[model samples]
Target: MTDSAHIASGHATRPIGGGGGKIFGFPLRGFGLVSSLLLSFASALFTFCVTTMVAIFALLIYRANGHAAVDMAISYRDFGFPASLVVLAIALPLFLTLWIRAKIMG
Candidate 1:
């Protein structure tokens, strides 16, 4: 069928072939890898910092409650790094899914 017939019938076929992919009017093909990495890493870093701070604070409170010297290393070893890894895992897939869906459905 002709393109005009599809349009007249109130049905329009979308172009799926990737050609200069863009989403929300912003160029994405060229930046998809960089953007995805940046977004995921940023999320992980933020989670690490915040969790580390909270861990340290909790350790300080523990020390104040008469605990034998709390090890600051536990903040990174036991809490922050693991939380960051989990965040990175979650954020990377979430970002990639949204990115791919946008590119395909756009």
Candidate 2:
């Protein structure tokens, strides 16, 4: 039925999203602020994992080279946590800027 007929019958047609949605729009139905956090956090987590793995590998190498004392905490304390924080800081701002740019341009 036509839109007017549907409206008169107390029913209204709505527009379906083109696909997913735009990156930015008036209704704020895109990868807005919350999504930027999620994406930045994910990137930070990835950085943490990679740095932790490298730190652990280095510790292993040190142990193999006749170092009797190796503290596993070094991997987390010296590398992973800081790296993740730095990545999170960088990524959050970067993603926010991109999101804002998309929003403004759109």
TM-score of 1: 0.68
State the lDDT of candidate 2 residue by residue for 33-85, as single tens digits: 88888889999999999999999999999999998988899999999999999
Clashing pairs in 1: none
lDDT of 1 by residue, 5-104 (tens): 9989999875543465565775544337568889789989999999999999999999999989977999999999999999999989877876787677
What's the lDDT for all of these models? Answer: 0.83, 0.83
True-structure RMSD, every candidate: 7.1, 6.9
lDDT value, residue 82 of candidate 1? 100
* TM-scores of the candidates in the order shown: 0.68, 0.68
Q: Candidate 2: global Cα-lDDT?
A: 0.83
